[model samples]
Target: MKTKTALVTGASSGIGRDIAMILSKKGYRIIMVARRENRLLELAEKLPGESRIIAADLSRAEECFELYEKVRGEHIHVLINCAGFGILGEFEQIPLGKELEMLDVNIRAVHILTKLFLADFTAQDSGYILNVASTAGLMPGGPLMASYYASKAYVTNLTIAINQELHSAESRVYVGALCPGPVDTEFNDVANSDFAVSAMSSKKCASIAVRQMFRRKMLIVPGFSNQFFVFAARFLPRRAVIATAEKIQSMKREEQNS
Candidate 1:
């Protein structure tokens, strides 16, 4: 039996960490990448199988390429781009510099890493790539989280389009976009999304994602309720959906303030 290798970004915590752990348990050697060196080192030590930690801030383009170079000789069977960040507030109120940083990490970095890995996977014509988008990608969110929604939308669409192209080329590569809603991770603390109540656990979410990846599913919206909501958002009028999101955000703010 051969040990396959999986590269999981943002693996220091939350969904990425869980994904790395689960992959390791399934007999895959894991390469955990994140900005938090201590957490990544701790996770690598605890994983069931062989693992390594690459502590690089993926927001930097050079670091993204550096990671690719770091594991050049290894055969990467899976590449999971779970590294991203979000900002919540009026677009104008958010600092332009902060918005650029969000785009750099969430959109640009994802694209860079995906492109780099896809070249290798395409050459072999067999591998899996998972891009973690959010259910917020399905529609426009309220003014508070506008840029974050747009970035996720880009991820969702890009993943689908790439999957189509791969199929057309008769490549065995599988590309999946994971669109989960309000997951119970450290993400809420960073995004300041107080509406995240009874959210799905990172462990549960990653388990489903891993299972679906091997099954070659193109898009995975984890929970049934979340899937239903995404479908509804797709069919609803844009204005109506935005208005509803505004109400939800307002209620969330009240909850946080109280």
Candidate 2:
């Protein structure tokens, strides 16, 4: 009997690591992808099921394609796109190179990997894709983290659109977006932002994400608060939503500096 395999990006730490662990416990052979080989090795040793590690920086287009090529032949039962980062600052103050890198990892890499794997999944007629977006994506804009917010919006919208296409085609390939709010992870340090509200545990976030994703839910926002925010944003005027987002981000930035 062939073992089902799940490939998880950003598996070095945080939500990705937690998701990988949960999937491993669920009897899926895990393929961990991240830049930190040592961390991945440590995690692989602890996982209950068999695991493989691929140390590659998905922020580079070449590496993203290379990763696809390496695993294209494997029967991947699931692909979780979670390798992403964010920078918090005024759009004009942020480095263009960093913003581009963020786009590469958060959007371009996701697009490439999804396209590659979706083809395979459709051919096999069974697979699941979970793209980790953010509650920020539901907002009209984010003042301090413009690029990051926009990138997540792309991820969220893209995943939803693809899932619809798959449904219309009558394919069993499930594609969904995990839109978590602030999570208690290294992401705060990496993004250079402070949480304005209480952050949810990455383990809790991952648990909900995995369960909802396999259940074939299209947009899995982890917490009730986050879901409410997303829902309310839909009713608010676009300008008002953008203003609120800006105020929230401004507060976060001030907290980070203080």
Candidate 3:
């Protein structure tokens, strides 16, 4: 069988970039999407297999439609929604517009693109959808990072629903949610989420996520420690989890300041 094409959003950096590279190495033709045209072009040039650089802000609803149109005519075997960011600090302190943008990118974009591609996938009876959520989505977040957590929670639930629907119908379509802990990426710096110790690398996280995805796992939490924390959060008191997260966030901020 000919290798299928893969579309990865946020393909310019972090986990998204690594995913595109990994899928390409596996002989898939890759379509890289992000707002940075230059970075996407650079990635396209370096990939072993054929790659297309799509420069579009997927945060916009119309752009999501355009993206679907661009690849709808082609054979897309997978869609990876990894274009997301967090704004740290108290919700009231964060700019309203930036928070809304986060919702647009993390939540709305995922929904719209998935809806568009799902129709195609159902018709063909095969495709994979990977939504990059976070460990924060597993629980109620701390004082800071409220909106970010809420958005991820939405992703987690939505991914689960789709996965359930696929399984119920005995379809080959697969959907997985990647709930990783803190990652060592430009995401931290951009979100200003400086911490005492950085988490795993984007490459490592991407590798684990992709592996689980191939296994058709409905959800994946990469690190042992992260899995432990999420498991505890599930049974522990909500206030306790919130307090722990606050302390961790505070320690990170203090370390950055020092």
Candidate 4:
């Protein structure tokens, strides 16, 4: 029996780190990628199975491609796209540079990596790709985090469409979106937003995400509250959903200012 390899982006901390740990325990050799080499090294040292660290800032397209090339020799059984961040502000108020960077990391990186790996997976007829999106992707619009939400919407939609394509082709490759809401991570500090609601722990979220990935679930929304909100968004009027999202996001923005 050969050990399977799982490559996780944003593995320095938060959801990515937890997911890597879970996969390691589950007997997969882990390849951890992040901007912080030291953190990845530390995480690699603690994993139960064989692990490697590839420190690359995935926000850059060339870097993403380079990272793919570096690991193309390894048979990656699972690919988890968890490298993304958000900027909490009105679309117009946020710096254009920052917004573009967010898109690069949240959308472009996922697209590039998934495309590269999906080809390999389909060729071999077995693999799993878990793209970490957010509940914000389910909403029509997010006022304060507009660009971030839009980027995630791309991830969620792309993952689902690819999953369907695989099913239609009768292929075994699994592609799914992990849509979690407010996981207790460094995201709040990085995004500069305050949470109005309680957050799920990163460990719990990762546990559910990994289990669902193995089951080949299409849309893995972790918590009960997040699942309910995603379901409710589908029934609500688009305008109403957008307005409600704006209100909730605005409250968080206000708290950040206070």
Clashing pairs in 2: none
What are the per-residue Cα lDDT tens digits for candidate 4 across 102-182?
899999999999999999999999999999999998788888889999999999999999999999999999999999998
* RMSD (CA, angstroms), candidate 1: 1.3
User: lDDT of candidate 3 vs native?
Assistant: 0.90
Please report the TM-score between candidate 4 and the true structure: 0.98
lDDT by residue for model 3 (1-258), tens: 666999999999999999999999999999999999999998888999998889999779999999898888789999999999988888888999999999999999999988889889999999999999999888887667789889999999999999999999999999899999988888878788685555899999999999999999998999999989899998988899998887877776676677
Assess candidate 3 and give its TM-score to the true structure: 0.97
TM-scores of the candidates are 0.96, 0.98, 0.97, 0.98
Question: Candidate 4: which pairs clash?
Answer: none
Off by over 4 Å in 1: none
Estimate the TM-score for candidate 2: 0.98
lDDT of 2 at 122: 91
Q: lDDT tens string, model 2, 9-123? A: 9999999999999999999999999999999999999999999999999988899889988887677999999999999999999999989989999999999999999989999
Instruction: Write down the worst ten-residue block by lDDT for model 2.
Output: 66-75
